[model samples]
Target: MKQAFLTALVCSTICSLGAPLKVKGLRTESATNPIGVSNSPRLSWQLDSEERGNFQRAYEILAATTQEKLDEEKADLWATKKQQGAAKLLVSWQGKPLKKGQKVHWKVRVWDKQDRPSGWSKIATFVVGEQAKLLKPGRISGFESSSEKLNQLYRQSIANLEKRLDAFTEGDVAALGDGSAVHRSARAFLYHFDSVPHLTEWLRLMDSEITKDNFFPIYPGAQTTAPVSSDSGVLVTHPLWWMSGDAQPTRSRWDAYEGHIIAREAQDTLLKGTKWGGIADSENVAAEFIDLCYLGFSCRLILELALPAVQPQKAIRFQVYASRIRKSFERQFVNKDGSLKSKSQTGHVLALRSAVLNPEQKAKVLADLIALVTKNGSKVGPIGAHFLPGVLSLTGNQDLALKSLTSLNAEEQKNYTESGIAEWLMTFVAGIDTIAPGFNQVIISPRIPSNDSLSWVRAYHDSPTGQISVYWKKLSPDSALKAEVMIPTGALSRVILPIRKNQKITESGNEIADAKGVEIIERKDGKVSLITQSGKYSFLIK
Candidate 1:
């Protein structure tokens, strides 16, 4: 009897200890109940257990438009019935197509290694966004390059940015000091991939934070008296307006902030003069570089705004204020030999990008920048790092840019924002850029390195109109170059092909001039520029 009782107690204890795993931390698209989720959202959840060696062997997910349906296991939306895999993250939504503004309720259950099933997790929900249709299964922008390291970096950067989107709050992005700046800097790249609804939502939140004093906080929702950088508001609003072609939201905010900007300009208080002219943030050299860049960028934007007849005088006056800041910058920062007084990489990059340097100064600055990057290898802080790769490519040092980019260690790469890396790869490496807002017109000028370090590249971006793709490769070690381009319907592209001495260009066995949907715009400076309508075209330069 005693032996039997002992045996029964052991059996009961074993059964009790082997309870099912509990599910928690349910997420969709790396967010907890996110608003504006993608149509085909990625689902994820965490597993909890007390037993040692407990591991998930399989999972089941049920999604519905209503909680009642999900509770009844109706799965009116999607049901992954007994999926056999260890994958618990980013499981693609395979149910019905999610509509805009529709709330999707989803829950999950997992089986342990011993095949014991867990209870269904609490149902989580995510609302579909208007632009959710733009997101595809994998990456928004397709990228592959000669260097596998760069290709991996491209993928990792895109993933990081998607994850960062989860940090969006009611009033701030990531709730960091430079959250607005990140949003502003990321606008163009996001638009390149046709990802804009989240940015639009962020802009709306920022607009609401603008007080009657016309003061936008440097850190939204933070207790601080410091004013935002001069260009923050316009930088975010103007590009969003151009990309989305939605005028009302941008126009209304512009109208509200215009008076404050003008008042500051009139008072010459847009920035404060320090050893470095008009340092917007006195925190560090990185912050100072960012501030100066913003001032210069804001000036350029005002000049662009002045080109139109609407409020020309105000725009002109702003330009004048901008000129004063430019002169101050040049006087304080540029040395006699055109070298920067400070040997900071961020400062050099921003100086070139902000249009503060004259042609001669720019040439000298470019040389200096190359030398600096070669020595340090992208040692800038978060803010400065954003502009480094793009600037390096723009100055015809793609080799150096690639070197700096691929040389980043895992931790160093993590420190850099996804926007900078993605923008550089898409805009410079693949060379697909917008000549007009909303990608109505594009420029396909792939910059191949003169050296053998990089041999081929292929990339595509889904624009608002349609998908624009480009692929280019060298036919031989020192021979001809071949390029393939895809222009979407209702869009125009300017395809620029580099020409070497004694090389002839042809399209599909004929001269490029005779190709359909192709119009030669100009042949200058060793490049033949052709305007192409929506179609695929292959070119050979030999």
Candidate 2:
């Protein structure tokens, strides 16, 4: 009896040595510690203990949308009810759909091998940082100029963009799910082609789509389905891809004169003459011009967007090809008088964007194009409908860009057009241009457009460096513009804000009279420029 009692005591002591099972480390999908963007993110946790043989037999995970719910032990969002398994990685979330930017609070408890239940682990938290939508703008509220009405409109626009980008998926972009092949392709260029923060990933997505269509020449040859020239080096309009195979059968038969020409041949021919006509089956003259301009843009994209990010050796051959196409575009499209042969919006935009003209020529062309668009009373074509605003902004025509975006009524804001507005606001208006390869450096130059009513503007961008924000307010027409900028970590910036002659500039409420790491770069075209390191800066353009 005494031995039995001693044995029971010893067993009890040994049981006490087996510490309770506890979850020590927790992580979301892709091992994102605190920031996660996946809507249906998988959760994983490591069951830990000091005692030997204390393995996890089962686990119960609880996730809450709010910290309050989590603290109160209310798993209102998601709860894995006593899942019996050793699977600790990528445990799927069978719960309510996660909204963009939702913060999730989660904790887990486990049952040990001996069936002893452990207490809930410390409540860990993660923020849903990766939203499928455009980065949200910072809040701006005050009783100033047109606050209630304009603010509401801005919010609505942001909400719409969020919804649209959230729904935009890889499949949506690749298979022309959103529209026809041309439309989807244009949308891809507008949204993510050259300027997305994730440059490499964007290129991958674009390359996949282009490769799928066999990288058909811009113009398809006599054979509508078969390319008379399968060589990508040659520039042809593949009709099926161009118009979604909608051209009447008759047009295709007569336009076989210039069926397929190698890049070299096209370049030489274009340099000699201005007649860059399409095949018989091709679209109208203006449409053909637009198609050719897009072809040039595509080739330029290969150089500008894909070249630096890809292997240098792999890109060298394409680099040569792209340069020839650009030069050909310069020779074929633009007249000696800095006027486009097509005299269309697409022609003007592509000419300005391709940088094929000399400085004097560019200035003349910009003035003429501006006059053309303004004279046309904003009658932008389909291709122009997408790229015109961005081109205007790029050419230092912000007021016109604003007019292009806002002149369209609420009902007319479709066809991926608002993306241009967003781009202008976030990039040109806010003045956040990525200078380095991956936002390593930035040029933050905010300008007040001619729209006098826009007394204040605030914009944000999620660059590769991090979140960059710019806000500016014109206290009065004659008063200087007050601008605030938040530069992301690991980025240097050159800030250029509008200022009148003899006006002073202040950073963070202190006159930058003797600031270090800050110097006047130049005063050009009514804007004062300063180079600065990364930090939050507030400038009074007095």
lDDT of each: 0.68, 0.53
Q: Mind giving the per-residue lDDT tens digits that candidate 1 earns over 311-372?
A: 56667666676777777677777898887887778778777877677888888988888998
lDDT of 2 by residue, 1-542 (tens): 99999999999997766767767556564233445446777665655554533456888989998878988989998888898876565577788887767888999988877778999988877666663332222222111223333344345544544444443433233221222223223322222322221221222333233323233332212122222112222211221112111122113311221122233244434433222323221212343344444444444443432222333454455456556655665676667776666666555665666445567767877788799777753545333545576778766777776665555555445433433334444555556666654354678876567557467776665443345677888877567778887665335788888877878888767767665446687887788888876557778877
Badly placed stretches (over 4 Å) of model 2 are: 1-213, 216-285, 305-333, 355-361, 410-412, 415-419
Q: What TM-score, over all chains together, does every model reach? A: 0.69, 0.56
Kindly report the root-mean-square deviation of model 1 from the true structure over all alpha carbons. 16.8
Clashes of 2: 13
Residue 311 shift from truth in candidate 2, angstroms: 4.4
